[model samples]
Target: MNLEETYRSLGLSDAEYARVRELLGRTPNFLELSLFSVMWSEHCGYKNSRPLLGRFPSEGGRVLQGPGENAGVVEVGEGWALAFKVESHNHPSAVEPYQGAATGVGGIIRDILAMGARPVAVLDSLRFGDPADGRVRYLFREVVRGIGGYGNPVGVPTVGGEVEFAPAYTGNPLVNAMCVGLLRVEDLMRSRAVGVGNRVILLGARTGRDGIHGATFASDELSGESEARRPNVQVGDPFAGKVLIEACLELRRRDLLVALQDLGAAGITSSASEMAAKGGVGIEIETDRVPLREGGMEPWEVMISESQERMLAVVEPERVEEVLKVAARYGLGAAVVGRVADHGELRVLCGGEVAGSVPAEYLADAPAYEREVVEPEYLKEAQRLDVEEIPVPGDFNAVLLRMLSHPNLCSRRSVWEQYDYQVRTNTVVGPGADAAVMRIKGTKLGYAVVTDGRGKWCYLDPEGGGAATVAEAYRNLSCVGAEPVALTNCLNFGSPEKPAVYYQLARSIEGMSRACEALGTPVVSGNVSLYNETSGGAVYPTPVVGMVGVLEDVSCHATPGFGREGDVVAVVGASGRASLAGSEYLEIVHGRVAGRPPEPDLALEKECADRVRRLIAEGLVDTAHDISSGGLAVALAEMAIAGGVGVEVEVGSGRRPDVELFGEAGGQILIAVPGERWDEVREALAGVPWQIIGRTGGGGLKIGGFVDLKLEELRGAYGRDLFAEETG
Candidate 1:
């Protein structure tokens, strides 16, 4: 069956078919069909999600550029605006972790670069199966390596990210990458196919056969046999991508182009068609005019190929030569493959013969598809379970160690150490901090950044999941001593028409809205990627939230590491019991996976986050880390390991030792305050629940009324077993 047949099967109405036929002529061939499928697929097409995504609140005086283009931009003083975006590469990573993850990093960077911004930081939210599984291990290693390999080489800091493991993700691992960039508000680039009689230039990598039907590939479900579909995977060369970014940003500043877009997804065909359609103009392309990396390529290969490091530019007719000269100066490939036309038809010529022609709008505007929704059989069962019986390990100490060692809770230093996070001195607090801190030159103000998500929990409980992601990001920023000011998100989910999926999707949005409203941090901008499914089944609902906060004193930022020996240790905020709803502890350490993950109490979260930020700025808190994922035990252990010192703790009277030490609770922070400032610290948190849990001292970690472990032992849980494999 050809592409047209598939659309017909998708229940496209006669009007839609006639519109598509008008673009490709009488009857469409395989190539034309493939192009149609890609342009009309939900991912590139947004057939089902466009309506829902339109509901997000994206306008604000600070919003320099919102949603429709590459990444969102919001002004952040100092004559600067921040550009950032979060995106998912689930199917591809599950198929080929390394390259898939590498390209994901590559793509997001290009998005920021396309807007004339300099990428500053990158963070990833990863989900995998049990590490014991050989396949999962391989995927994990490769995916981490790929992210480090690409991001490190590009000189962008891979600062803060989170990892989680669950059985539900075994069949489809999730790799979501978010990139943040800095651009002068005045220099921001706009994407609209404007200007009449302009020259259309294809710049960067030459057209090739790679990812020939990639957009269609994304639209369909992944069969178990993904190895056979390697051809659909787009190969990445980060070095080339880095060069392209530099060239593009430089060229944009020189004012040599009218409009710009990165050639992603459906490649040349989609970019050109969408650009023209958005500008209400037509485009005429000569297939033979494209620059090719390999010979013997067909016209379709030139149009649909998803080659990396390529961009499209609409240049003023007279400035075409100047644009070509600038591209040449950068030693990049440049070609004028088409011309903007006054008519509204996509006219294509192959060696002077009209090979195909179509209405630009029809090819670009996919028919809105409504999906069948059936509640999953497991939803009710998942919510019906009683929480009173949630199990707590008898030997909580051993459990803490196990949880720390688990891939999800362990430290990510091994993965990020390979990255040069400090290359740009603007980075005040690098990878080890809760959020990546970068100084805004020429001003005392600085920015704190973080990205977060949890797919399984979000899939099971959309509202809670969505709220948790936003809260998690804010908590991270709080730990770094910043008050979150703005948020952006990349919503990744399965088919929206499925009632269960739509249910989750809608609740997640509601959750986000509530969290943002409560926190006083508005949603600046974001992107939505729906229809992320395979033949096996739909992926768990994954929504990544990227948030930025402000800190006037970058130098006072707190980190999750030990700062001084003999510093008094304190715990602030509420503490109760661990929620296993979507915890690695329940799924991995124990053979149980029931209940719900802890939900954030917006009121308590604000109090805790705000208080901690104040203390850090006042120089009363030496070090701090929010209690999340692995809870208090993991957070404390991470702090000790990072400081290369040990801690001694005395469990307070009333609270359960096990719960106080290992329970997963949000709105709580572990801090190391110098003895001199103990009184001041106590005064600062007056009227709020507080505890003098212990003190940081030389040597190993010691806990009273709880099972004990040495600081070195705790570090071993996250130091990585791979290091010994090579060192041994």
Candidate 2:
């Protein structure tokens, strides 16, 4: 191929080529060009997002390891550390749902394992188009199946997650996976290749042509011609993933590995180069030495192919044989592909000939671009809707039932049942709660995790939606009596090349940053998935926040259920006032996704969350649930359903009945306290905003004179099989 053709095939612009030549002081060879292409691609380089991501606060007292590692690690007390992260597989999932979603799980599990932690649980945050469309239904079904298929065999419980549907995702669906693991703080591992003579070992699976240029592929937008990119999607093997996890932990136990890294996105090129650059050392890899699934593969393909279930480790030269034995016992491929060098250049040898050599820093650090941001014109139209224009239901009882039955508000039992959530016996609280709580074996400490997002809210007002998303996750953790510690996010946005999309990205990050500061939760690790637009259109700027909090005593945790018949139900922090703008009621009932979302008051949010957490920890409250989406009515309904009981509440009728019952406001929580402890609970919550609104004993839910329904009636509407119509 001619020089220009070669450059284009490598996904490099003429300007980038010139930069590479100037840096190298000479023309680069074929292998060097290929390495530069994958490493500098938007997926690996964070070219468009690096500057924005810097806005996040990434340090805290409890943080042991922050963003520059495989995963963020936080001290969880009792000599244990938690490692966790969330990443996106959007592009691949849209093209090939099953394999794409499956590998996303496999990839994240390895990330935790690389830190010498035993992965305990996996959660997912998914988005799809209107389920009424045949293609959207198919994509949704396969993505869920793929997540369960991979996670179940790997032995990690699929605990809890969130899913949303919207028209923006009709052509580009999103599948983001998060994994959490535990390990002794002393056993934590780093990804730097520190020792100059350490052996570079490639473990698990053979290299293949599949997923070639996957990083570059992810950096581009999807068009009608994206079908041809199917080969770039990596196929996953969960059984292999299981075995690899076991072998890696065993290796760590034996103290055999000096450093390790998971082979994701850019495959060997990224792993090997990042390891070298981080340690200020060099690496030499023989392309021919890499185990290949297919013969006659070119050197560049072997270097960049993102084969699944693979890891690269820096092993002590003396203990290489022992490490190989452990890998062999697990039936994994272990090959000594190279060694760390004192020289600071990455050298590639093809068929015993030096094919390429370049400075490791040049490949690892891609140049960042500050894209221009212009306010989206559609925002003006989206913000113009008046809540008064939308009609409120005349019969409040029927409206509550309809809202409960809506797909977005309905129970997800059908989906969670397919997961092996009870496995490993460490799950203290599994799916169906505000957050999944898992006990650390042999300790009183536990960790709580929750994944949340609001796509329609974000689409209408990116800033408020972004702040609200973080606040929601924080409140969920607080409801469970856990102190918010740190967070990992997966930011999915449209192409950055468009000024309008860039504005959303910038404003959302600003909002998240502000909320994180107000809530005192640092962002330790995250992934950015850009170019999530197709010919159909761009998706709502969806930012999925996965938060981790620590519970000092596992026994003190709370659930969203009425604990006793005579318990008094109270609304804490703020009353639920209906703001119909960008609400589910407006979207599902009126067929429009417009208007400003509820304004998030960060100070009030923090005060309310702190009050709720204190009440639970002090054992003054029996049940706690946050008010979101469908508002106070829905929160009360969910608490009753989980407890299999009923409640009698009185709405003050001081405002519109609908606003009092269904306003989508933040900074409010529903709490249940024993009748005997009413005085004590009230005193402890003094100086905090709260109102005793109801009692938990009854056979039917009574909302004053507005609505009353049997407990079973509420359950029947909320618990119906969600996908039964389509599946049958």
Candidate 3:
């Protein structure tokens, strides 16, 4: 059975069935329906997305928990863990970008806090249509400001992430916010509303019309006009979020709560049902007892409302008052809204009337649906074309600058700068660096993280794209002087019913496995989102990859930004004529996107990365950055801006702009070595594809074969025009 049929038998009324049926001709089968519930659910599904989410990496070890739970977890060790997860607010964002994206961040943070961890960082991955689209441009501007507004005030470092523009997302853009927290293994909190007689407390914001029926709202497609969905998009107050984090962590420290869950998505309904089911217990919620910001809400409205900055806690009966005191300390609302029962039913009552009841197990454990696999006809279409036969640009420099200035390749500094990346102060290497690095307080160790995805490439060649995504993440860590230890991923794809989607997923998985095996990086946690399809079409296959590496010395890491004038710039690894078939540069200039990205020779990549690490440690390299995305030109410009210096380089090839500058090449590093140590650095990296592209000088970026532009101009190209002229 497929996804459509399962809903048909759900005993829906003709109208409701027709609505579900008419949403499209397809009805998932029983199993597909179950899987659909899990995958499409606010917890599992990307329904509003049934489009646009095909851009994330969903595999790797340092991962403690992959998708499919309250949150995803990665190993952060000495017997510690970091739980993190990224979820979309497309529908909500469409309704209210500020509150939508803010609460999205707040919600993910609570997921970590509930796991008995202290959130240390937040990352948001965003997408919008071409800024030329007024509505999208407005939404994009507001969303960025909103995410920054919330994350900044709350003190969680908004580290590394990306922004992209594509017409496919015009109608319903995606905003995925991820939060990661630190915890000792022994302190991990589990959500199980166990222990009969435990009081269910609602703390944080008072319930209101805000975010009512968010789950049901999310379980549908966004038709662009989201007036009706406005109430379902929760309002956020990061100040309130900050207090809640402190209160909860304090409560946990005092052992005042038995179990806890964030009131997100389905709000009380989901938290209660899931917690009850997880603990093999039942819950009886009294709606009248729920504190409300406004009066006269219906029982269901109170039960399912997703008001932001709130949490549901199953407190030890004896410690309820103690936990209440913590909320009081934070000046937050606190109320006993329900109680845990030995019976396994999730019951709700209001004004002495039984409003509704259901088996906790049914609500919590939505059936997991396995999908039917069908291959798309496109793979065969792609296979028939000879990659070498594609047209090559006569001038690579023009292509390099075009790609460097492409919205996707441009500097994300504009977006990240608005965010207070240095807020927590633990941030050792903030945004604009290869990976975001943070120091472990009181410890000599440091952590490095980065998120990478190439949706178009993944769409064109899943295996290569997936492998490259992982390799790119590892390379990012290495460039920052950290050794990648583990990985976590979020797999975003479209309807899996089509063999083509399944093929993309399977091939990508193969790529991940092969790359991990070669690099010795293990998969620790992950999440998979499917059914991201819309009436228009499915989103490009996207696998967002998140990686974490460790560095013994926090001070030794490197960033892509320019360091100092007169510093020698050297390119490590072989320079090849990159195939521009599916290049972002090609797409921006030539109006086409297809073909494979540059493939990494794993053996060669490992050797080169190790040598760079050694050189950094030997103090021979002043600064280093990885060559990726927009290739050497972008890399050079980034280094120049970061160091607040200028550079001049000359490649051996007469064709300066060729693959060396614009290609999405991997396993390449640009190092800034002191002129005095240039000889030593060259000798240290002997036998590698290393070359002196140029030296830092002139206070502007000068790519011999490309247009010369001031460092400020190059930075402006990446930051200013990437968005539409008006918006910028």
Candidate 4:
């Protein structure tokens, strides 16, 4: 290929090329062009979503480190802190499911480790297309296997996460990974290389040609020929990853490093340039000094290869020997590949020759586009569902059975069974719960975390859907008796150049930010994965929120299952106000994906959630779960199925039975209290709209005297296997 083709193939526009030339004030070499190509791409530069992301509330009392870091850190309690973040590997997962997902998990772990914390737990949120399709089924299996393959061996507990299936993800699946780590507040690390003349170390894995142009590749749309892009997906080594985690944490413990950064996306170019920019200094990297796994790799190849299981850090010249000694003891590759310089320019050297040089600040700051978002005509139509015209099911019992067995609502036991969730023994409540609660070992304090999003809702109403996403996560944490603190997110959208996609992007951010401000759960760190479009169309805007809540005492949290037969069941807040818009029942029974999702009342949401947390803290509630998705009826059935018992509940007092029974309105919670504390339940929920539905009991589910089904039948439908049905 010629020079122009080479640069264009890297996803850089001609205008951007001209800007690079202007910055350098001269014609550029291939090395300089490669550097700018990946550094300025959407993956590294966040050229499209950066301005929109600024709308999120990113400040709170617990946030120690916010955006621009490898991961965000929040103080938990008693001199301990938690570092967490969520990142997406969507395009790669669609192209090469196994390696793409494995490396995604590996990448997020390194991010947590870079903050000088011991990696503790992992959670993932996945979205796939119609499960009945053979290709989508294959992708689902391989992706889950890949997640378990890497996480199980790394000794990090693969706890709880959510998976949903929809047609919007037919050819472009999203695999977003989240990792949580524990660290003493004093041991927190930063990526700012403060001192000039400090030596930069390349630790762990070696550079190769495996994942060249990965950042540019990820920033584009997929097609039927996406398989041809498989080589752009990096391979992962879980064993090497586990060792690197240990080696890096050991380095931090010994205070042998001044700064650390994980080598991901654009690899060396992004890591070095970003560190230099953040530190307000310069970095000079020698490609000849970099350890390589392949022969005859070009200078640009070494600079941009997205090799897996690697870290970049800087240390004082006098402490370099100790760092090298730690690397040697761990049986890993390490080399002094660069040095901090006072020139304020990122200079590339190879075999004592200059290959490229650019101002670090200019390289890190890409031009942000201010796109005008025009609401789509299709969205206006989609939001115009006439609820009164839609037919309600004749048999509520049969409808409940169908909703339970639907692919979107079935049990995920087969998926979570593949993961090793009991590793490290910190997990108090793992999968099959509202949130995964992990203890702080010797102390009574703990933390709860969950990943949640509803793309179908976002497709209907971006603003309301976005706000509801944050609100649902907040309520989910509160159900488990944890106080919501901060969150990390993965905003997956389509091409922002498209007016409709930009509208979804902007409105979703605006909505979620407002919710964050209301709930006081600020965004700390996040990732934006765009261009999730195939020839079919853009995927639904999926803004997955990874929220963390703090627990004052680990031993005192509520599970989402009935513990006693005599427990009294009650619905709190606005249960009667539940509506069927953007609900699973609407799609499954009526075959429509229309209508606005429930608009969350942020003020009322926080008040109700706080009361629920108080109930759990005071030992007045036995079980708690939020009403979402399938709404009141499905929530009751799930609690019964989880506890292996039957429940008889009287619901749907005066409203339409179907909407009251299955509507997915926000700000409502279901809690079961001991029979004797019914008075206390009434007293605690005095200010909110609440009602005592019924009492938990016998061998069947009796809902509002209309829907009645055997517990055996309910469990059977809930556990029905979609894969089995598809294959049969």
The C-alpha stretches of model 2 lying farther than 4 A from their native spots are 726-728
Report the C-alpha lDDT of model 3 over 1-728, residue by residue, as the tens digit. Answer: 43335454332234444443344355523322222232236443332222322333445656555544566666665776767666666667876888788887888888889888999988777777777778888899889888888888988989888787776667667777777788877777878788899899998988887876566555455654456668768889999999999998888888888888998877787788888888899999998998888988877677767788888998878888888877897898899988999889778877777666666775654333344556677765653435355465776545555566667777776677788887768988888778888888877778888877767777878888888888888888888888887666666666565677877877777787677778877665455555455666666777777777777777777777666678888888777745564666556765666566666778788888888877876667648888776667777877777778888998657442545466666888888888888888888888878877778888677766554777666666666544446432
Scored by Cα lDDT, where does model 4 land? Answer: 0.90
Candidate 1: tens digits of C-alpha lDDT, residues 586-637: 5556556555666789888888788989998988885888877766767778
- Report, for every candidate in turn, its global Cα lDDT versus the true structure: 0.77, 0.90, 0.72, 0.90
> Lowest summed lDDT over 10 consecutive residues: which window, candidate 2?
719-728
Residue lDDT tens for model 4, 198-271: 99999998898878989988999998777898889999999999889999999999999999999999999999
Alpha-carbon error at 714 in model 2, in Å?
Answer: 1.8
- Span of 10 residues, lowest total lDDT, candidate 1: 719-728
How does each model score on TM-score? Answer: 0.92, 0.98, 0.85, 0.99
- Candidate 1 displacement at residue 690 in angstroms: 3.7
Give Cα distance to truth, residue 412, candidate 2, Å. 0.7
C-alpha displacement of 263 in model 4, angstroms?
Answer: 0.3
Candidate 3: Cα lDDT at 197: 91
lDDT of 2 at 613: 94
Q: Choose the strongest candidate by TM-score.
A: 4
Residue 288, candidate 1: alpha-carbon lDDT: 95
